[model samples]
Target: MNLARGSSDDSGSLLWGLGAIALYALISYGLDYRARARRGSRHPAREALHDLKDREEPQSPRHRIVSRVIMIGGGVLTGLVAYTTSGTLRAVAAGLTAVVAVTAWAYYDHRTETRDSAG
Candidate 1:
């Protein structure tokens, strides 16, 4: 008996799943943003262990806005690709690719800021 069945029209489920993942990611990001903002980026672990405030500061508004835009755009791209392709795997792959691209962009931006600060 072989049970490797797959549907070509699983776009509905794929879109739903992608939306759920994006929603989860957005919530996580928002919570992290708020927590870090409130805590002021100081290493809580070190503060607990050595009683020191974090010298590093919270990210700026521009950074937060850009990150949020990436997440939203990724979600939209995932949905659109899924709708157009009508294939579960392809849609998922597209969504993942979008997320990776957004993350890489953010990382590059962050590295540039770090380099600018150092130099």
Candidate 2:
């Protein structure tokens, strides 16, 4: 299927959409696995950071701003890429990629925070 030209068939578009969602889910799962594995290793810097946070909270306005910008930019990029091609499969895949990336990031973030708080 040529993705350069947008396909107008509803069936094709529906398939593409579903495929994209599935692909995204797979990618997110993969990221979760990697994050889980990596978390097992201890890092001195991370420990130190945790200690510092426990002792005194540091305000990171810049960090918050950067994170928000990245999240918004990433969402825009995903939408653009998903809609760029004409083929249903391609577009769906692109959209799925974006979803999975975001999902993975959230999962990793949650895990890290949970672990940190526990430790």
Candidate 3:
């Protein structure tokens, strides 16, 4: 398969898969928002990693279940679409590139926010 272009048949699935990825991101963000509200913390992602002393209580069972479902199901489906569009190697490369780029961006933004708040 061409790296730069997708076949017509694959285009629709790719678009749909992209949409699923976006939805997963939005849902994850929304989960973070709810977690923030529960914890009364502005940076939920940082706090959610551990059971901080100030955390009000454990998240509800429903919230926890929904988070798992969205993460696993959405991720698997998006990955499947990517693999179907291209072969294994290309899909892995694309997925890694995306993950790395997003992680770097998030880290940079987090650092900036911390610096701004400190100063």
Candidate 4:
């Protein structure tokens, strides 16, 4: 499928992609709702909209490792999807962007950890 050309064949794939996204969103929402219910949160919408503050407890090293692994895996998956759907160039760009983002996040996390430990 040549995505560069506005071909009718692309429309079916686009619709399927959109449907998949919608289904995933719905499932995510349901899970969040269940979690909120379990927590006895009255204002689910407000809680969802609220920015995540730093946790009172520090994350364990294992947790940090798992989080980083998941982040990198997500990036790789995104790059692969872009490669299959768009092209090599787009995949390369996406992969690079993901790497930069992950690097920045890791640096920020390290700085925060050091600052917390010092003070």
Candidate 5:
């Protein structure tokens, strides 16, 4: 049995899956915007732009720990999904990539916080 050739038959299924993801993202964004509006954020775009700036205050150690835990949990969930949908190799790659990415993010955040506090 040619696995590659057999997988080609499910090309349409892949497209449908991608389309569903896109639709879900759109709805999520819409709901977030609605919530922001309800909160009296008259200038959502401006608020978003402002949010891109460095935070004036550093996150507490407790918050950082919680964030890291949540991020790792998300990575594990992603790995499980990849394993079930794809294969062992892909799952390992995805899980490792997620861990590396999250580590890099944490490092960067820490560096930024240190720099901001020092200067």
Candidate 6:
């Protein structure tokens, strides 16, 4: 599929869209893993950054669900903007933006089991 031309087929574009979402998810997961694995390092600056990525702020289960919902909404909004305003190039940029934004947000906000919530 030639994404440069912005494939005329809706099916092709839909697949690309789903692929973008999955890519973002994978990046976010990797960042979380990296932060956790390197958390014990003695470097202060790196530790501080990783701590944020490790979700230093305690979040309830409800907060986690809401954050995920909002992140999905953001991706959908940016994807629509990129597709409508430009072509495949902009769409690719949108995917990159989503990856970074989602990864950073996931660093501070994450999924927690409802059963673990004190409420």
lDDT tens string, model 6, 3-116?
Answer: 664565444555555656666656655665565567665554555455535355456656666666766775675555454434567567767677667765664464343334
Candidate 5: what lDDT? 0.49
Writing each residue's lDDT as its tens digit, candidate 3 over 1-119 gives: 76545444555556655654664465545555565678688766666544322243333444444434545564565555554555565456546544544444345434544555565
lDDT for predicted candidate 1 compared with the true structure: 0.53
Ordered by lDDT, highest first, the candidates read 6, 1, 2, 3, 5, 4
Candidate 5: tens digits of C-alpha lDDT, residues 5-103: 344444444544344334333433444345457779987645534432423246556545664555445454444434335435544554555555455
* lDDT (0 to 1) per candidate: 0.53, 0.52, 0.51, 0.48, 0.49, 0.58
Displacement of the residue 11 alpha carbon in candidate 3, Å: 4.5
TM-scores, in order shown?
0.43, 0.40, 0.40, 0.36, 0.36, 0.51
Question: What does candidate 1's lDDT look like per residue over 7-106, in tens digits?
Answer: 4445375656566456545543544455455768665344332311213443455654565566566656655554445456655665665666556645
Model 2, CA-based lDDT: 0.52
Clashes of 3: 0
**Taking the tens digit of each residue's C-alpha lDDT, what string does model 2 give over 92-116?**
6586658755764565455555655
lDDT tens digits by residue: candidate 4, 1-119 = 65554454444445443443343334334444554567799976455333122232344565455545654454554444443354455445545555554555455555655665776
Off by over 4 Å in 2: 1-7, 41-85, 88-104, 107-119
Tell me the TM-score of model 5: 0.36
Error of 2 at 39 (Å): 2.8
Alpha-carbon runs more than 4 Å astray in model 5 = 2-8, 45-119
Query: Best candidate per lDDT, number?
Result: 6
Write down the worst ten-residue block by lDDT for model 1. Answer: 47-56
On a 0 to 1 TM-score scale, where does candidate 6 land against the true structure? 0.51
Preferred candidate (lDDT higher): 1 or 6: 6
